[model samples]
Target chain A: MAGSSVSWSERAVRLLRRMNSFYSAGSSRCQCWHFSVGGMEVGLVPPAVLKQLRRFPEVFSFKEEKRLELNPGLASYHDRSSAVDRVLQRLREEERFTCLQGWRDEKYEVMPQFSDPPLMCMERAATSLFGVKRYGVHVNGFTRQPDGQLAMWVARRSLSKQTYPGLLDNMVAGGIGSQKGIRDTLIKECAEEASIPECIAAAARPVGTVSYTYEDGEGVFAECQFVFDLEVSSDFSPSVGDGEVHQFYLWPIEKVKDALVTEEFKQNCALVVLDFLIRHSYLHPDTEPNYLELVVGLHRPL
Target chain B: MAGSSVSWSERAVRLLRRMNSFYSAGSSRCQCWHFSVGGMEVGLVPPAVLKQLRRFPEVFSFKEEKRLELNPGLASYHDRSSAVDRVLQRLREEERFTCLQGWRDEKYEVMPQFSDPPLMCMERAATSLFGVKRYGVHVNGFTRQPDGQLAMWVARRSLSKQTYPGLLDNMVAGGIGSQKGIRDTLIKECAEEASIPECIAAAARPVGTVSYTYEDGEGVFAECQFVFDLEVSSDFSPSVGDGEVHQFYLWPIEKVKDALVTEEFKQNCALVVLDFLIRHSYLHPDTEPNYLELVVGLHRPL
Candidate 1:
């Protein structure tokens, strides 16, 4: 077992070297990851495992490099070296290990497959690889009602998951994992999170793709996000998904500003969705020139 | 001998797979190499090798890919994989047989240090990879001259080269692989090709990067180009590199346009360089509004 662990460590190092060589040759900028978030220690995560974490925000934050540590529970799995070692160890030692059978069940619908080592590496390093593909619709304008202004639909995430859990997120944000297209993911996630009908989701037009990197206490995460803006009636009501979401709310452009400024909205959720709104002129640029500029400028680099 | 050939072929396949996987995962868009250019076959050059080509286009294009096919004496090297296999067999048969020592010494300066199997495979496959990198820059209007016309510095590429040899190209243009930084490469190439002094090159402001894929009989090629717009005095005289260039001329915007359209300048060279001028409004937008719009819109999708 010790010899096997040593071999796995050597293999992990080799994989990392290959990855580094590939990245260095290309011009695309790469972000680094530290394992833990805030005051947590996450050193148990192998460097190769942590390397994959750089792609998702739910798991990593580049800006929080120094504070990145390991999850304490991962210490037992440290010497295992290979990902398979850890998985097999868990199966033998834990009662709930049998429940993890779903991870290997290819027969299950909508479940991710983990048969390939490199792919499994991507899955275990969940945050960076969790870019959900979705369709974006840019609505031109909205009308104000007596009580509130009518605009398109958007959603806030349930805080239970990882990173920015309870924050207001995309109107329809999702991760584009293996075997899923952006359009299909959008439709599925929107339906699950907002109770939006599949037909309406299908009608959503894609504007373009926006990629960004966000770092926090978790680890450095990258997102190749698809932004969609949709127009719904003023009388429309939202039904939140009990499984994926905590609640849903409709805000006028004015109220959105307050929600965004306060901690109500997730990191840049308001900015990205609002930028799409202003670019298509869905909201009056004059009322919130500063917000429009901020959002639009965020899409561009200096 | 047959075993060695099979091993080399397997290595080539492995390298190709790795290249394909890397590009698909990271780049915005990528096209596979399926055509041969000059003497080289396609889909053999790895990203590192491609980057090497971009750096020293003069050496790589002139000596490596270009000379291998265009030079009749070297034409014997063109039997594809079978020819490579035979060459390896010959090297094995004659223990003292060293492979092209003279050619190796000549190309050593520009050739990147790569490993054996992949490097050998790249040499045999004759493939080229091309793509675009976006270096976004904001351009303001250009200054006009006292002669009642817009004065522009037209650059001439080194004459001792391939493709539009000795003709005017851009205010400045060079391959990205010339050096580490785009700014540094542009400065060096401009200084060498057009005789723009180091002091002036230092002041040049970057406009943007233009990426394009070009394929001819030689091979598939990709270029990540950076263009800059600098203000030069109307009376500014350039000291051209006599060995590589004949002279440099500062022309009125009108003469430049006529030269570009009439093929008085090299074909497409005028169109591309002139398009940059128009897109940035260095030329009068009202008089050439259509031309301006066309060029600006050309880069929108990219």
Candidate 2:
């Protein structure tokens, strides 16, 4: 939430920024499990899930266990997920959420217990996993002004998109939609969102992630958005590489600040840009009373 | 809360920084309330407290209510609090806990609901109110290097201090004790800790705040430390005026980074300086994969 002193666009951005943050208790009752098809104790499934799981004994198991677990005897992850997918397909029909979107052949790694060995390699469809955590990256494409100032590249998202259509977005953003690498995601997003060549897109750095947990009536949304800052040459011009972006705009830091502090840009973009400003020394702790608060508040403790 | 990459002092600082942030659920089972000596709905007092309040009906009231409350019709704030103070003084005798400190005649405002227009103002002896929220200011003293680099002033608290004695700290830090304003606290602390003259201290700019929430068996601790950046001249040297500080040192950004990454500073001070490093462009997103996460994670949502 934003304070009254914050301008309009900034308020919207602050709220949007809250999408990946921790505010109150999440509404989810389902547990999040690991790649090994083990149950994540943090999540609590509704009572009805017991009856439903009973119907998929081959795919799930509780038989005298502490919590639900994926049948360890499954042949492969593909076999297990496809079985779970079929259940979800039927669930979609039963629940009548035809408008559901974001399903993909690729999967997102959930409950990443380890980064090196990846102790539990849990994978699920990019869609149908709303009640758990997800990951993505948002990049800020910028250039140094002649006076040594910073100017940013902003993308006007395509109106046809489902979320925040026609609103402003980061220069590049893409989900960790599959079992893909962070650098690969940045390169792919850069090429699609801003027409940056793959080689140049690969130069985009992976900074860190911004995380949040929010839940509505449907399910809880816990996400970690990795943030990036890619400095482009002064002569660089961005074209809409994919149809997802309507157009691109190059604006100085002041104009970008106007957009953010006044609520003109899309919501999450506010968080990305605000981070940019603070890290770049544009927003000083002395000048902004909430500076340290925003800095420490953006990430969740591991 | 510090990651494995963070240093020991930095990790300690991060933990101290968590005292006021509401990332996880607070320990209090009771709901928080306001207005006229009433039960603090949130905090769970020991069962023995009922007898204490019963002894101070003139100052405190919980005769029929479940929560704590102040006598609404008290003649003056002092009259009401003095009555309550007697109860606490007597409770100390019963508990037999020695060496309790911070019992100043001053008070701190509890539950600042609005960025502006604070809702309920309850002042209490600073010592006895550790379980509640408190406000303070922390200033980062910096100077420009002749080679276009940034160097900072660091302070070491006196061994005689009650908290984190002999530990590294920001150049200036002081609680918003009594009715002191944020700026006033900064100026006062600067002079005391680093012997920076009042006029020079006044030149400091107000940065944002750093917040966190923490709890132990004793009580829940919520704190907001207003941050500042004061630029000093190269020729200046600090002479400790207050007994609280033992010494001061001037070091460039590189040494400061070593201290932070190696965990040499006090816990909250680590966060303050880490924010400094990122904002000053010492840590860039291109090089640090966790840049956005750190920025967004620093501040808690309102």
Which numbered prediction scores highest in lDDT against the true structure?
A: 2
- B1-302 per-residue lDDT for model 2 (tens digits): 44577654344334444533334555442432222333333233333344444666665555444555666665454664465556566656566323224344556554332133222333343222324456778888988988988899988889888777888888888877655667777888888777888989887765555665554433344566777778889988777887888888898888876775444577667677876775565665434545544555445543
**TM-score against truth, every candidate:** 0.34, 0.74
Mind giving the per-residue lDDT tens digits that candidate 2 earns over A1-302?
44667564345335644554334445333333321354343232333445555676777676443366667665465665567667666655566333234333455654432132221223343233434456678888999988989999998889997666888888888877546767777888787777799877776755455665654433445666777778999899889877999989999988887776554577667667776775566775434554544655455543
Q: What is the C-alpha local distance difference test score of each model?
A: 0.40, 0.61
- Going through the candidates in order, their DockQ values are 0.02, 0.19
- Please state the Cα-based DockQ of model 1 relative to the true two-chain complex: 0.02
lDDT of 1 by residue, B63-177 (tens): 3332221222323323333344344344335442222221121111011111101112222122232221112111111336876556666655566644466776555554433
Clashes of each: 42, 68
**What lDDT score goes with residue B35 in model 1?**
22
